[model samples]
Target: MGLASASLFRTCGAYVILAGRSEARLETARQRLGDAQTLAFDITDSEQVTEALSRLPEESLDCLVVTAARVTHGPFAEQPVAEVREMFEARFWGAYGLVRAALPYMRAGGAIVLFSGVLSRRPGMNCAGLGAACAAVEALTRGLALELGPRLRVNCIAPGMVRTELHDRVPEERREAMFRSTGESLPVGRIGAPEEIARAVLLAATNGYMTGHVLDVDGGHTIRQYATRQ
Candidate 1:
């Protein structure tokens, strides 16, 4: 998600600083981005975030997009507590830390775009933690929008099931069923790509009047509940 957002932003004439934990993946993403700068850091660590931002000039950032998250699939009772904690750290605290660090660098007219999943609004089995975290993301966006008011903009993009490597963890049968069902269920008849979600983020960041909004980049997935027909 971060990679997609960075690529889209760069293509749209923005200088992006890509940050992540894995050096190899970050390097690969940097190469794909052509000329963007890479800053490898774990967002969950405050010291790391502070150190990373210390290198940047004050008020130099035009936008900040937080797309880092972790997801796991399984029945709620069967899922491990530690894994659930990991998700919260990644999706919730990580984003919060990024926003905290980046806020100083963002001046008026600057924007912050955070990622939330469609499941925030449309719950699914075994996704309670993920859904809750995403819902918090939306709430944070709105709250920050109100607090930052008339200067910095804060918005969220809630995407439906996007085809990414992250989705590979789902059982094969369930994954296929998800694909088929989502295609039929959504108005667009297909799952979205990361690039599509990236586009929405770009739009939200650039558009001046679109603050405090949770833009659904989903294929209208939240409009109707998923129920089997008799």
Candidate 2:
């Protein structure tokens, strides 16, 4: 998803910098984009995030987009606190640290795009920690927008299930079946594509009037869930 967002920005003529924990993956993604800079850093580590952002010139950054997430699934009663903390470390603290580190580099009127998930609003069994973590991100988005307003815009995109490498661990048949079921359940009649989410991110970043907003790029998932409940 992050790669898709970076590619979209590059296509739109913005100078892009791809950052991740894997130097090899970042290089490969950079090559795929023809030409773009790369930064290798562990986002969950505050010192690493600070060091990475320090490389950028002060007031040179025009926008910051965060799409990385770590998902944990299990009943609340069964899940250990340590495992939940790990999820928060990746999904929540990572974004928090990135925003703090990147602020000095961001110019006036800059935008920050953060990602949550549909589960934050639409409940799912066995996703207690995931939902809570996503909700926390949404809260952070609102608080940051209010705190940094007029000078900088902060917003979030809550994406639904999308076709991304995150599902590679699942067996082919199982993954396909899950997608098929999910697609049929959604009002759009298909699962989302990474490019679809990327387009939404672009809109959020470029729309000067949008701030303190949580845009749901979730293929009618929330509406369908609400309707079924009704």
Candidate 3:
């Protein structure tokens, strides 16, 4: 999903700096993205983030997007404390650290995009930890928008189910069924493609006046309270 957003930005003529923990993946992105830059830093490690960005031309940064997420799904009672901590570390503090370090380089008129999810607003069982993580992201995005404005803008894209490798954890048959059922339940009658979510990220990153907004790119999932497949 992070790569998708980066690719979208690149296609739209933005110079992208892809950051991640995997050197091999970063190399692949560098090659794949042609002119885009890559940085390998674990956002969970504050020192690594600081060191990495400090080495870069900070003033070159115009937009920031936080999409690295640790996907966790399990009953709250069964979810390990360490797992919950890891989720918050990656989802919340990861964004927090990046913003803290990047702000030094960011001037007025820049934009920062963060990723939340529909689960934050419509969580089902076994998604408590993810929901909490996403809720914190939304809260942070809103607060930062107010605090960082009228200079920088901040917003989150709360996406519904999208066809990505994130769903590859499930078996093909089950995944297909889940997607079908989920699509039928929504007004759009289909699950989303990753590019759709990426487009929203671009909007959040490019739009001058949109700040503190949690833009829902769901296929009307949140509004269809009474709409369900038979």
Top TM-score hit: 2
* Cα shift from native, residue 110, model 1 (Å): 0.5
Candidate 2's TM-score: 0.96
TM-score of 3: 0.94
Candidate 1 deviant stretches above 4 angstroms:
171-177, 228-230
Model 3 lDDT-worst window of ten:
221-230
> After TM-score superposition, what is the CA distance of residue 40 in candidate 3 from its true location, in Å?
0.7
* TM-score preference between candidates 1 and 2, better one: 2
**Cα TM-score per model:** 0.92, 0.96, 0.94
- Evaluate residue 116 in candidate 1 and report its C-alpha lDDT on the 0 to 100 scale: 91
Candidates sorted by TM-score, descending order? 2, 3, 1
Q: Considering summed lDDT, which 10 consecutive residues are worst modelled in model 2?
A: 221-230
Candidates sorted by lDDT, best first: 2, 3, 1
For all candidates, what are the clash counts?
Answer: 0, 0, 0
lDDT of 3 by residue, 25-101 (tens): 89988898899778889989999999989877756677888888888889889889899899899989998889989
In Å, residue 147's CA in model 1 sits off its true spot by 0.5
Cα lDDT for residue 185, candidate 1: 78
In model 2, the runs with Cα more than 4 Å from the true position are: 225-230
